[model samples]
Target: MGQTVNLKQRLAYNYLRDGSTKFLCYGGAGGGGKSWLGCEWLMQCCYFLPGTRWFAGRNNLKDSRASISVTFGKVAQWHGFTGYRLTNDGIEFDNGSEIIFLDLTYYPVKDPLYERFGSLEFTGGWIEEGGQVNGLAFSVLQTRIGRHLNDKYGIPGKILITCNPKKNWLYDLFYKPWKEGTLEDGYAFVQALVQDNPFATEDYIETLRNTNDKVTKERLYFGNWEYDDDPAVLCDYDAICDLFTNEHVKPSGVSSGSADLAMKGRDRFVAGHWKGNVCYIKLDQGYSTGKSIETDLKRMMIECSIPRSMMIADSDGLGNYLESYLNGIKEFHGGKQPINPEFDNLKSECGFKLAELINNRQIRVVCTDAQRERIKKELSVLKQDHIDADTRRKGIISKEKMKEILGFSPDYLDMLIMAMYFRIKPVPKRPKAKLGDI
Candidate 1:
């Protein structure tokens, strides 16, 4: 006799029953039993179909080992498939179906993994953290599911995805598709929250509730994706554009610069040059090597006709490497350090300054289609909460807000925020008094 299933598990089972369901997504609050449902559903697929091959993946291999593999191990044991071999990152079943565990962290490049894995023609798959995988990566994985067609295994295969809502790029790929009712073409989505599971202990649910911060509480529990009651946004797109067009704005007289450093895979460098309140963007979307970034910077400097000291570069994460490289160049060639401040701190200070400038009618932005779209999609999402409720109450809604309202992720808008942040004034310094004149 099979073990009795829970309500959430039954929903997942029903979705799996319709072999036509190409994609199955279950997401929302934590402790919703989404992971458990996913494990049991995958196991059942492997059990019922001979020669069926499935892959279960997460954001990282370590997580795959600890969560997906471990959970599936217990489920397999309960379901009488005890002799399966749990290897480095996979579980092999007795009847030739295998559950291979993979991670996105191992492969950041979006398309290559698809080319490599898509060749295998997997019968089915599951993405554990649907929120983390890039849309391109998820799309690539989806292509790999249609090689075999047996009566037992069904046709077109299927993919099971599980996630909690996060305001990242993946929102458009999975959440929006299903939420908008367009998923009927190739997918079916089901929302599961902690409150939906009866077996989940009240204490556990309350614990999650207690531990969740204000943002998490809003996003996870209530599924509210609005601007958290925080204040940090300095300018609203509508206001910026309005002020610029109405002539109630001042030009900062400072130019803007953006930098993209090369990483492990393909690198596309972009920078925008602004002067007297006009922006001219330059894009370099091609192969860039580690040795060529300096050359690229020099070319950008020439194009903008700005001294090396005036340009600002992103120096967080891989950006640190670029910073170190520029510092090395200063020591060897220029005999002075280039001004590349810590991106995050600089961004905050710039945001604050921009807010002040906007409040005083000292700055203007052109409402160009590119600029408006970028602000609506990117800058709108970059706000941090203000401590005072009254203060936080003002300004445009955040990306999370837009996601709840619009049902899509904002990536291009984020890049626009970075561009704006790069142009903010350097940290204020104490003014020097004239020598001997107090």
Candidate 2:
């Protein structure tokens, strides 16, 4: 096509052609020629590599057709590549190469695991507006690629993702790790801002610049992912992430243990040992019996020098089994009446306090990268439900709703919030620092 792309697009192309990188994340800001780059690259690959199957996907089919499909048509016209017919579901080339379009919307009741994509085969794929799609869909897409014409054509499995700045799985999996300089092997990220695209029209640039909305200006114009304007959100996005790096929040107050118990299923049992505002995860594992959880909790308390009186466990459901085994331990009743009349229940009171501590940079969480990722995802959805209803009591979104947003229950994050119980109703005297022993 002899079309010229900017430097960031070139960098993404290099990553795609290198064969060593399996995932390449391209665009951050809007109008960085994201759709064009994705479309042009997929079309060229379809023409040059015969008999290879590719997949193009987005949050929904309508979005794909309106944006990505139109861009693909423009790319084909620009390159003068003929003999390819667009079907309702995909595009087919005369050379037997095809690109199937897919809608990656997640429906909990209909297709929980995204099994509809399980039987597909593709050499590569491109996910447009990846920020809008769920992580489970992306994961399912990963498994379906590299299954068609890979060995015969000597092409590696590659998935190109183009999205504006968003704090979803892509941010957790790519941008944050990339910023930390610890991006995993076979993953490459190239950040492209709007100003980097020379092909962007001057009128378009001026319109973006003239926008008055702070969130829109920060996200689309400056590519800032940290600014979130959702009215329901209780905590700041950056402050929630800073839980791992808040070094100034020293360990000095009470040394307590908190656990959110789950037994023999997909839910996880997460326990943490806290020293003042800093918490260290003691145990985070799946499928635990009551006896096993009691044993582990006992061991962790002993290891951390946390007394039975200072430890607390969830009193709901299976946690009752754990509380029964351990006498004299405090039981956290999430449904109980709150100490503060302003809140709806114990969980809501604690949730608001947790948000406050996190936003104020008073909480610190020391855990693994995987745990940190889950914590970020969970805390990002800590919203003040029914804020405008004066008759309704102030509360956080229900656990069921949060579970729908996150694929699993927010076990680790719940443990952190449970630890805030001590802060809500403190002991008569704060315990001395025992960091040396822990």
Task: Summarize candidate 2's per-residue lDDT along 231-341 as a digit string, tens digits.
Answer: 788988779878999999898865899999888865888999999888999898888887888899999998998988899888366566666778778888888898877
Instruction: Give the alpha carbon lDDT tens digit for every residue of 358-418 in model 1.
Output: 4455544554565454444444454644435653322334435545423344433332334
Which regions of candidate 2 fall more than 4 Å away from where they truly are?
80-85, 94-96, 203-218, 224-231, 241-257, 262-311, 315-319, 322-328, 336-345, 360-377, 384-395, 398-409, 419-438
* lDDT (Cα, 0-100) at 17 in candidate 1: 76
Clashing residue pairs for model 1: 225-400, 226-401, 230-385, 230-386, 231-385, 231-386, 377-413, 378-413, 378-414
TM-score of each: 0.59, 0.76
Candidate 1: worst-modelled 10 consecutive residues by lDDT: 329-338
**In candidate 2, residue 381 scores what lDDT?**
77
The local distance difference test score of each candidate is 0.59, 0.86
What would the TM-score be for candidate 2 when compared with the true structure?
0.76
- For model 1, what is the alpha-carbon lDDT of residue 437? 75
lDDT at residue 306 of model 1 (Cα atoms) = 53
Backbone collision count in every prediction?
9, 0
